[model samples]
Target: MKFTRAICIALVIVLVSSLDLTSAAVEEEIKVACVQTELIPCFVAAFIGSQPSAECCGKLKEQQSCLCGYIQNPTFGQFIKNSQNVFTASWHLEKMIIHVNLTQDNPMPLEAGRTVDLTYSVNWIPTDITFARRFDVYLDYPFFEHQIHWFSIFNSFMMVIFLTGLVSMILMRTLRNDYAKYAREDDDLESLERDVNEESGWKLVHGDVFRPPRGLVLLSAVVGTGAQLALLVLLVILMAIIGTLYVGRGAIVTTFIVCYALTSFISGYVSGGMYSRSGGKHWIKCMILTASLFPFLCFGIGFILNTIAIFYGSLAAIPFGTMVVVFVIWGFISFPLALLGTVVGRNWSGAPNNPCRVKTIPRPIPEKKWYLTPSVVSLMGGLLPFGSIFIEMYFVFTSFWNYKVYYVYGFMLLVFLILVVVTVCVTIVGTYFLLNAENYHWQWTSFFSAASTAVYVYLYSIYYYYVKTKMFGFFQTSFYFGYTLMFCLGLGILCGAVGFLGSNLFVRRIYRNIKCD
Candidate 1:
């Protein structure tokens, strides 16, 4: 750590010494001016495009000494790695030159409202890559505007607002009805279930609905698998924020794999517990599913993408070295988590079904067509989560594989939070709606709702690839679809799992809140 600090200090000294005289003079007559922004990357990208803008150039020159410092600092590093690798390769720039001495009479060029300081333009040649092309940018106002930023933010936010409103309204209504029925059953505390059974004619789920799924083990496995995926994302994000992994680079992949492998414990635990609650009997299948599915899916997709990347000269084949690491990780790490979850689950007794006294049962199924059918509700269920992501997902797809930088982690985090809310609300509403419709078996409703988003995502990707992307061809198409599907499905499932967890907690809590008789 000390050595790294020393190197940084030395670099700063070099930078300051190199820029002092020229920068001071240029500051007054700015060549490349920088716009103010909270994020460092925004400053850089705008400044780059600002090159043709004399004001921007002046600012860049003035700041040359400090550029290295900015690079060293964590906040600004994201911008450097993210700007301009894709469609706008030949966009105009507004770069600054630090030390160009400007005479008082020879004033630096200025924008309409902004002043230009001393700056110099340098010949920035593009790298010799077969696919990507680049040319020098003219420093102009046109370059300073970052189009994608607004496009994504607007698109993403709108979706969130709509979805959140709709989902929330539906769930709240369901809760109200459930509460009413629950209140009605307040008299018969001891035989609440029996009273409910007597009072109602149409309960969504009958006695068989509560039957312990035959394969307790297999149910546990699915739960575990889903849990592993859940942990993988949380750990990756936390690690990135903690600086253990660089989000800008491909270290995200490694972080995900490691986190996923490690999270087998969470998967096993959650899956087993949920299954037990559902009265599932099979536990061994749960273990196998928990351990095997994730590794196999990841390995298969990674290999496919790697092969496609190889054919296109975009990446080398997955090294045998990586394969060894993968095997080691899966064999040693994940298996234990599954085993541990199973052991814990078996040792731990299941919760009694009657956490809350059943206040009321069902009313006669009035032979009336319902406004919301399970299938329709299930389909609509995905809209909330999908809305939360479509705008951001659109940008992400364009950014990845297309070689663009997405530096808006702050905004992404905001969307993520919003997405979580939307998913839960959707699940709760769907589950409630189904139950109210006399179709009470909604265990899978949580998963299905979130999974619905994946459908929209896949469709959107298809449209973007065919319509928006100009440079990519058939192989890119195939590779794109393959990986995109992986992302959407995984994301869908993750969202669904989150919804399920949240709904389960909600349902249990509500069920526990009231007295039956």
Candidate 2:
């Protein structure tokens, strides 16, 4: 009886092993069938047409287990990882449907007896990855969270500290001596002459420094627009943080448009106050220009891009109804708010409060070294500010160009604050240098200095296009550069306004305590 039982147990073990091998072979065959017959043809046909057919769905349901096995297999993993949800649903016998809509207005016709194929691939193994964290497969964690990124932020913070210290030292030491000399009660002609001779730089141009800059209307408009843009960006960043705007289609853009319309008053107020203080008589023109300058520029670029999109029959083309809605929002809400703000600003803060009286005849600006010239100073002023936000720009470009979602608004906020500080410090220094060269044309110089930061950013975008992205063809290329140009324009204006405002305060403070004839 014991020998008979042992032989029976051995026979049972052999039968079980053979069944396991047979199951493995069946699974392999099923996987091959699923990939070749069910997945490839269905996915390709669905991509080319509107949606998958009933037969395609039935085949996918029948091969659900095989699909999961393929997902687990290293060789076929990439081809089917995205279909995990389908496999899971099918495994549980749940009803799930997927639809693919082709965006082309005029799709090419399929030739008789000809077949089309699509090769879809992904670089991820979802064995241990959760559905929520699936996007991590595409994110470049090493690039974004690298030590160099943190170091860049730290370096920018240090630069702010150093610049503030330098400016403070100038105020305490250098300016103190000048103040004591100018405020002295010495009635002696010789002493006064000596002090006058020593007071060559910056002090000589105090009278002309507060004079209205050339193109005053345009300057006021741009400054106001910049102020609005600054507010718009900050609001958008905050909302994105709170709302996870990246998860929703067109959420960020919708927020931006609404916020821009709401913030139109800022530009008007700033422009109006500056224009009024500068003794501008063309109030109507300034108000109109302030309200329309940026919007028109964007509209022009968008119009061109929209035309191209329509020509190509691409989904990127904006519908006429959407365009009309945007125009309505701008015309009714933005324009009126800007007008109201202008009126309020003119009434409230339009009074001139210059520390030094303007001379009837403009002071003759002496020739300075090339490096000290406004153009050169303007060009160089952007370098440090650009450096401050260089790393942040890489992340931003990647999020937009690549299929990555941007969720790091906290980092963005910090970088934005740093960019503001760095821009102000750099612009103030450039303005000081220009003023010390006996030039009173510091208004536009300060604006241009900060605005030049955008020039460098635009140049960086060019480099990224050629090196970091595989974007090709006329439509994609035109849209890429066009959108970048719009972004850079807004950035330039915002930085320019911040720089001017900071330097204006500095100029006022420095000139306030001095004796001016």
Candidate 3:
């Protein structure tokens, strides 16, 4: 989650999309700039309370109207980070003050060559006070500081909403109609006689649907870790929304690391309960695997990326102190909490129940067409989830790689919800189809079906590297792909868990309601 935290910080800091606005003909027409380049020197002098040079003064006077235009421009308004900075400054020192005496008490226009009397006062501040200032200053205020890609966000939302509604409508209508037909047929003697022969598909295989996946221990570990991560992310997002976090540059990273470390209890509980339900007695092994898998993977990837950052002398690199802190937090607080949760979960969890009893002999799965096969279904299953998120993903990629500003967390949170909804819907629908096709190996299928979204994410990342980003060099490329891989890995786990849980519940409910003999 450290890399995810880094990505999240990188996610909401800015929102500038890549656009090619300068054309050859437009460039040819502008002989001089709208704002004079020479005025920069004058602006610097004014910043330190000094008078402008003669040339600078001439430029300032010449561009006074243009300066006013720039100030009025909304795009230029962001240049001043905050107007309240004067009050917030650490020291209250007056560099200089001037007093003027006018002839009239009321405001009046100045006559040519009019004489005015002026008084001056100045206060000095100590070096210590000046050195204590921590806030940033900008030479010129920026435009569109809180800018969001509203159009893109809205478009993505509409598309996802349409797809989700269509899917839900189709599934509900079809399932309701089928349930009605099956119920009516149950009263007919002829239909009842034919059911045994007709039920050779899903009905015949109900016994195996609840069978534990082959790698139950590892799968349980993945699901638990993923569930913990999902909850951690949701909490962090809520914190940001409520302003508990979102303080500054490092806020997201700091909050994410702390929240994720503390949430290890969730992972332990989920893993222990799942392992117990699957009839596994090795609680310690389950706990170790659940706790270690993602952390080790993240640390390994982060270490490599940090080494690259150190090589390039980039501040983005995680410091030694920060790494030590993270390690200590994980080892001391997280591990202990996980152990406690594991014990509680093992004690609290009861024996598992299946809607239908399993037979002593396993049923053979009939042959499936290419389209109905697991590989094809898994590949196709990711499309909707990917579509729901691809637009938001582009913005996220732009923020990380292109050094753009992106402060649209609200939009990001919305997109995230839509992605989860889509992942669950598609995976459940896919699971239902696979079951009807007489394929009961749904455990891995459900996970891979939803986790397949990561494949598209990785593929799009490749496209972005070639088309969207002009980034070069071995270090930059490696860092991009390496962090991307981690991001995909985390995404897979999170999304796969969503699909697995949803499909698991759906299967249980449907089968439990059926009056099996």
Candidate 4:
């Protein structure tokens, strides 16, 4: 039966080739040619058993007279005659239907040289649905809107509320006491000296707290890039909510590229202000690094993925023209905006604003408990933030990997805001602890603490790959993890920068009220 169907399909191909159905219109006077051209649609309808379009049916009715004549010709008649038991066609009330009847009750044995009939049918049923809504059938609303999903969102929201309250309590109760004690105006020198000696924790490191962090240049660049990415992600998500960007092919990617270029100034302004305030001497290098850091990282990943795709002959490979266009966009638009932003930032808000004057000699960082160490603090800082967004990550992963359409942008927006708030709160708390441990190097520690959220997310992705998804093979696994790595990298940097900036402000505000020499 399969062999018989193959022969019939081959015959249809041969017939289509002989007719030379070009895009040129078939004149009414050339009846044979017109019928042959119209038959192209019928051939497709019969071959694939799909519903015939209005155009296909209209052409069939107009050229109905010439169809029989062409089919009966000696050259084409033999194949049609051989396949007559397997193929049948009829038209009724402007509808074209092809039916192939096979006797299924009496199963035929498959043997070489035995002719078995193949049966199939094509029925064109009218539908009122518009062309734009053809994809509605594929959307699984129940799965997306399940009770578990809503519960997860609510759970995350509660976590945010809890974290917010905790942060507020720390600021109001703990900080207020510290402020009152630090701001005491004692007239007696001996009492003042006693109080100074009693001060232990954050106050002891005031002079060194605001000193420039190590690796000032690289830190500034990543922070700047992370700032740009944060803004870019927020803008893209809002646009997706407003524009239904998921409906169009490559729309999200195009929007990301364009928006990233337009938002380059954010990175430049941020990196520039940070570098200048830190007294960094390499201005040009800072500006360049801020501009190229994220883009180059993505480009390197994309280049590897594209090479793998090309090797596999997959359409996923990015064309060379697209690469050139992306490079041109960065070079012409993104790079210059970053440069302009850097200049503006350097001249505007780049002044040093440290509340405490740095001492001449660097303070030696004393050893603390294992839990209070920077590495431990950084690693532990991400837990609450990750918990806040863990469920959202599952939805996102399903949409990207499991072929589900993600339309819950409102949920996403809420989750994103929650992640940001939780990250900031958690990192600020971690920074406070580190400072209390007399660790003056809170800048990078704060950044890493917040950035550690991405580490958890990446680890979750690995677990999801092995358990939740059925993804296998080197090509698919590599692409999945590679893309996840890129996402986590950006996420880590964005969260890290947010954490550091929050800690920076907290440190500045608290110290501003104290008597720093």
CA lDDT, every model vs. true structure: 0.56, 0.77, 0.68, 0.76
The list of candidate 3 runs beyond 4 A from truth reads: 1-173, 176-200, 244-247, 309-317
Q: Compare the candidates by TM-score and give the number of the best one.
A: 4
Question: TM-score, each model?
Answer: 0.62, 0.77, 0.69, 0.78
What would the per-residue lDDT of candidate 2 be over residues 1-517, giving only the tens digit for each residue? 3323433333332223223232445444434433434365443333332234566555544344232212222343221322112111101112211111111121223233333332222122124444444345455777677798788788878888888888777778877887877678855999788867666478888889999999999999999999899999999999888866875689898999999999999999999999999999999999999999999999999999999988866658999999999999999999999999899888888478899999999999988789999999999999999988998999899999986777878889989998998888888888888887899999999999999999999999999999999888898899999999999999999999999999999999999989898
Q: Estimate the overall C-alpha local distance difference test score of candidate 2.
A: 0.77
Q: For candidate 1, write residues 1-517 as lDDT tens digits.
A: 3323443333333333234243333332222232232233323423322322444334444343233122222343221212111111211232212111111122223123332232322233343332211111111223222585566557766766775677667546644565566567355666666646544322324432334434445444555566567667656666555563433356777777777777777777777676666656566676677677656776788788787767654434677788898889878987887778766765574764744433244334333245556567667888757766776776677667566554445556666777777777768767665655565445565566766888888888888888877645656667778788788768766776777677667656555544433
The candidate scoring highest on lDDT is: 2
Q: How close is candidate 1 to the true structure, as a TM-score?
A: 0.62
Model 4 lDDT per residue over 1-517, tens place: 4334544554454344334333323222233323435355544433232334566545444343223221223333211212222223222343322232221122232222334344333333455444445445556789878898899889988988888898898789888887787777764898767766665568889889988888898999999988898899899999989977877778988999999999999999999998888888898999999999889999999899989988865557888999999999999999999999898888887578788898888788888899999999999999989988888899899999998988888888888888888888898889888888889999999999999999999999999999999877777888999999999999999999888888888888888888886
Q: Once superposed on the true structure, which residue ranges of model 1 sit more than 4 Å away at CA?
A: 1-219, 244-249, 304-315, 349-371, 471-474, 513-517
Model 4 weakest lDDT span, ten residues long: 77-86
- In terms of lDDT, the poorest run of 10 residues in model 3 is 80-89
lDDT of 3 at 319: 79
Q: Going through the candidates in order, what is the number of backbone clashes in each?
A: 49, 0, 13, 0
Comparing 1 with 2 on lDDT, the higher-scoring candidate is 2
